[model samples]
Target: MGPLRDFRPPRGILVASSITAAAVTYLAALGRLELLTTGNFASSQQVTAGADLQVANLRPAAEQQQQQHQQHQQQAHQQQQPSGIDTGLALSRLEFEKAGAYPQVTSQRAAAGIDDGVVAPQQQQQQQQRLVFEEKLQELASAADREDEVAHSRLLWERRWQQLWPGQAWGSEPKCQEWQASIRPRDFRSTWVEERLRGLPAQSGVEIGACQLRVSMPDNVQMRYVDKSADAEFLKSQCFAKDGAQRPDIVDDATRLALIEDESFDLLVAAHVLEHMQDVLGTLRHWLRVVKKGGLVFLALPDLCDFKYPFGDRLRLVATPAHFVEEFQDQNASRRNFEGHVLEQGVSVAGIDSLRAASGLPALNRTGNLEDLESITRNFVAMNADADRLTTKMTVPLNLAYSTMEHFGSYCEDHPHNVHFHLWTRNSMHGMLSAATELFRPLGLTFVVEELHTAGRTEYNMQELRVALRRTG
Candidate 1:
């Protein structure tokens, strides 16, 4: 067959090819056959050269991907819970747990009460008038970025509320107000006291840095780290210590000891510092030490019992005042300049009375206890301008410097009287003064009233000063 152009395969080889085709067809018919029934070819199984082995390798990866997707979905579902709702619920529960109504109150919280509710409409109206002394306080505190002033204000307000309204109060209710006249203002026996704070002449000879502890003037403009221009007249006279040794160190609340020498200060003026102190007696003792026997300490503070900030109602609420006067020089403040004080609560008065009784001021329990404040007026507390950090950068202000006069003028008027944890009445003032005197008396300290230029909170017609006599053995 002429080497037949198309050679016919041997029957055996042909049959083998046909059988192979048939096998291929059969395998195709059973497409994607897997060794196991789990819809995946097992990757661990060894296989001859076939597509099944390739698919098996991919199956494991596919299954892993599906599992990962499911896990991701589950995790996502758990993340969508509301955290705020849970936190709010917890806070609400706590508030309710502490909620109280008409509980006996002390300090500023006493303003919220409902005992003997009968009162005159006009009187209530007068009591409702709000006085925000904190505006000025914030201005002063913000002036130097001092947060303590605001904190002190909160304390002052709380005690003030309690002192004005001595009764049961709710914890969360609005505090009610009482007429100024309702809580009769405690009058001092002007004629009974022998000592009086004498006003300083506008142009009196003054020298403050001759003593060992050099006098530090105020720094109102530079409190924020940037020095702002001040009155040229005031700035020109400033005696800048070469090392600024007289300035307060920001690191410690006290003056840097090394920087100070003997007899640096003949006068120490702090405004509204006494109110925030916990241990007034101890503080006074230390003050006596810091002062050079004859050096004077100028002070200014609020009388919550004499001002009306009916903080809240019902729940022995705390009206954290701008400050609290745990101890002070006196309770008798003039009502001419400052108004709307509410010192009705009796705790402060009692404390003051007790203190006066304990002291042998001689004038205590005298006729001066029941008269106008003109002769023997006093504010509730004193302040520390640099209380937070001891820094000479802080400064006093003109308005603050005149606090004594302004407060005295308002005090001479019909300022509302309120409550306080501790009120600084004439008796209390006498006690504090007596305590300070006792500590300083041994050092031969003399009390001489002078004019102060401090700004934080003190402003008055008179300031006290002490001069050290020649040291005795």
Candidate 2:
């Protein structure tokens, strides 16, 4: 105890000792006297100081942390909901309600851009609903536009179909109905022709030439048949021959016939006969001559463009005169002499001279006879030469020109007598008739076209063109 043995703690212990003393001082300031009254006051003071310090320093911080965590959870919950709801306004309203400040809270929320304080979520919900409504309206508008387009297309097709087959229902004829029932597709033009023919008025008197029985005259009409064959046996042999008992009224040739008087017939019907004539223009002129003024000439012929061959060379069958001559020359001549000269001219002249000499004719008589013979020979030679030149150089238009004689001969020899000489389209037929009118006007033959019917189908499917012409003058 001399100077109170100066008891200084170690540096590490000094820090601990200082902490204990400060803790005790803080506790004593709070007035806990029980610690000073105890015999083990130092130990008790250390323990109590630690407890008090922990409560004072860490409790407020922990509470503050818990409150902040709760706020974060509420914000997170609000964010998870739909975009329409607002958490800040709801929380403010709750706080103000607890504090009993209703009017103030509403005014504050309004200043901060909330409409009616509690109605913020409702406004957001309405905005979202409006956007959805606009999207639905756009979809409906697009659907309506598509429907309108389909309706317009349907109407257009209906109009076109009506125009094509006017006054007749599609596929409704007896023949077409049968075909539909059998599931077989026939050419529609055939049906169209049938309908048109059925619709025609009955004639008082009609003359039909080369009646093959494929088409018939109107019922109860006075009909006259003009056929090339008058022999019953020969007529019976034809495919469309009349019965052996019934005979034709007027049996005459189609090309050259003077049996009927001029303007004798009311309606001159020539079905599929104009194509067989060697001279179509001459035949037409003759027809016009025979028909009465203002009378109808119903002419039907196979359109060359409508015929199809498997080999596609059928079109070439409509040959020019030059083609016929060339072909005939190639087949008949030993040596191809297109100039209308004999292959061996010397032999032919010598044979003629020897024949004259062997006959013992007088010199003057022989000379006269030889001169006449030479003249005859020269005339024949000139005729042949002219024919050759015509055939070689001439080309008739497809619309006006018919089959060559050579083509017809070959066709008769090899196959059936059916041959198409020319090709014609609707426009071509119209143009040909118009040209004929001009060409024959100078000859006092006036022909006017009354009506024309062309099948509405492709060239191959189209069978014929029907033209009704009247001789006006």
Candidate 3:
């Protein structure tokens, strides 16, 4: 049976097997064709996967670079910016930072392809408003500082005023009758003098050249007197000598004043005496030495600008011209003629040092001859004529003879007579006192002018300036 089993298959079975094999081969071939036909789709899917992986790898680096660029831009902007309070750079920075305030600036930046990186318009406006508020705050601080300085100055001025006037009002009417009772010739009473006396404290005092009157000292107040003359005959010749009386209690030699103790007197009254001294500063130093600290020194002088002589209505004449003529004329006169004023010119703040230096010049011994006298007279006549012509233009008779006689009698006299050396206005006197204090401060002398008054020339009064000074040291 095993030998007989090796026989061939049936034809139909072989045909079925062949058909199956062919179907399998055909399916394999169809699969290869499908793959060749869709080759691009497969390749694309693979490429897409690779691209996704590459993107994931580069993302962190790109984000880091962008962050670095943004940081660089922010740093550059901060470096270019200016501080709020930098005055020198504030204007330009304001224009740059608040560019939105000006429409043209925005347009210019946009045209130039430069982005300022400002925030929205609303936010920029808010930032601009904040800067303006800060500037206003700075201005207010400056104003406050100035106001404080002004307030301090005002306080200092008030304190000085209080020290000067004390209990009395600045321009108050004084008790003239009590102070002027002893002064003879009521026509010579001065309101300024009365005011000065009334302001003085009631204390021990001394008077230089007390001809007949003891000024406003109370009955209890003690006083020592000084004068240039001790002789009875000379005392009787005084203008205030009513009954040819002599003052036996007075000490002579007013220049030295050796009898008075240093810093002993509380008040020093030199009504019209200082102008006659040869060394005015030396006399003032001596007088200051005798007066105590915080004591008063009352001075009264004739106002040079207000001439009381009868000059027929020359109202159009400039005051400066007449003043210059008088000053130069006195300067040319001989020193022996003590009748001539040594300092006839008005004292001023600007001229104090020059005047003091001039006072040191050697006194000339030569007397004025006839020619000098004639020269002065002729100059005076010419000045009077010019003044008359400029002012009135009237054919009024010029009293040239009387004027020349009066001038010669006053300054060119042979004998030594009382004559005003220096003249003063209220401002000039104040300046003089201030200049003197500054000049003499090194000598431990501190003089302060407390009050100054100038009386007007009325029918009954003579123009004069009265000053009150206090010795602080």
Candidate 4:
């Protein structure tokens, strides 16, 4: 072929060429593409040939070059494998793609008013500087994210302080000092089982909503997993149960436990289940009734202040013992209680009501009825929108208010079983249990907190509060 002049590459070839160029910078970061000292890649002859170069032709040249390189240095033979090739730079294909998306060197050269295909030394330097700037920007962004996480944690800690001691300013009390010092984060699971339950003459026990048994029972104990239904199909149909979740041994109401005889079991376990109960006192009484005297009732629940539940429980104050007492007195669901939960959790009221109506159940309206769907939908939309705008409650905008309303709506609609009726802290749980013991004393059933494991921290960053109550009646 005569000396090619003004030869323009095919579109496919140009795209492949740009990809190859980008790949060099990309692989260089991984220390895959080594620098060729000969500088033949950008030479005048190669530049002329670049216009008509095919991918097939390019691969052979690269292979030949690598073979020659291996022959020249046997020491680098092992390190120069195509699979493990490293270019000794920290660039990614995406970075290259984003920097110019396909930084065509020929186009760049022409833009800089260069007739020759080779880039000027000054232009090369500028390109290197740009890459360095991008890397530095990434590092700065990562550091800022870390700082934001720490600041948010501190803010939540401050909010927790306010919830515990309402109207009391942060860092202004001796109680706060004492509380901060007393936080010794730990996992209390083994402590309760080893100390309280191991040596006991416990024979049989039942666990409510036992997807996977939380605690390890003694070898002699026969533990039965319990849920609303024993049928696999029914369990799968429920919103909470994941695929292959443990099937329940007994089908019964969680609050009543009508099938389980009074004072029949030696032990009772309910992990992450109590919060779903509408009447906390009634549930406790039922739980106490099932377990024989001196038998332990193990309870584990999420802490209200935990960072894990930022959507709802973390935002609202812990439900007081008095509030629970009222719930116990009135077994029916109240509008105020439902409304507060919906707003705090960013859940949809229409979703809840729709499900309730579909199931032939009465509306959760002791006060707030579903007279107007538009108004209720508006309330849901408005609350979440305001939260996203104002609060640090959401680190990433999940669009739960508008776009993702369907998701939260479906959550309420599909799974009408339970939501967190009450959020608890260590102190709040203790107070409630203490009040429950006295209030239910007339029924000839009582229990005392045997061991409380509200540890400072656990593997989950924060441990849920677990309490072992021993039946005394």
Highest TM-score: give the candidate number.
4
Summarize candidate 2's per-residue lDDT along 1-473 as a digit string, tens digits.
00000000001111110112322332343223242222112232342343344334434644465346457756987755411112222222233223332210112233336443345665654443333333322332332234332222211112212111110111111111111122123344324334534545654444444433424444534567776666766554432233442356877766655687778776677666664444456567777878778766877654433322111111122323332233323443212222111101111121222222222321112223221324333433332233212211111111111112122123222212122333344445666677678767887889789776544323222245667898998
Which has the better TM-score: candidate 1, or candidate 3? 3
How would the candidate models be sorted by lDDT, starting from the highest? 4, 3, 2, 1
Listed in order, each prediction's TM-score against the native is 0.24, 0.36, 0.40, 0.49
Please identify model 4 stretches exceeding 4 Å from their true place: 1-181, 188-191, 236-243, 308-312, 333-336, 347-414, 456-462
Per-residue alpha-carbon lDDT of candidate 4 for residues 366-433, written as tens digits (9 for 90 to 100):
23432233434344333333332322221211111221223343333223344555667667777788
For residue 323, model 3's alpha carbon misses the true position, in angstroms, by 15
In the range 1-473, model 1's lDDT, one tens digit per residue, is 00010011100011110112222221222222222111122121111123232223334644465345445645877765423222222222222122311111222211334323456854443233211122322332332233332222222222222112222121111111222233322322111110222332221111212111222233211111101123333222221212222222222222122323433444343323343333344444444344454444444434332222111111122322111222222233222102222221222222222222222111122233223222122212111111122211111111111122222223223322111222243223543454555444565553432321111112221111111222111
Model 3 lDDT at residue 358: 25
Clashing pairs for model 2 are: 322-391, 403-421
Give me candidate 2's TM-score against the actual structure. Answer: 0.36
For each candidate in the order shown, give its overall lDDT on alpha carbons.
Answer: 0.25, 0.37, 0.39, 0.47
Candidate 3 worst ten-residue window by lDDT: 1-10
Clashes of each: 107, 2, 0, 13
Clashing pairs in 3: none
Reference-based TM-score, model 4? 0.49
lDDT of 1 at 161: 25
Q: Please state every model's RMSD to the true fold in angstroms.
A: 37.0, 48.8, 46.3, 24.9
- Over 44-69, each residue of candidate 3 has an lDDT whose tens digit, in order, gives 23322332333233346444653454
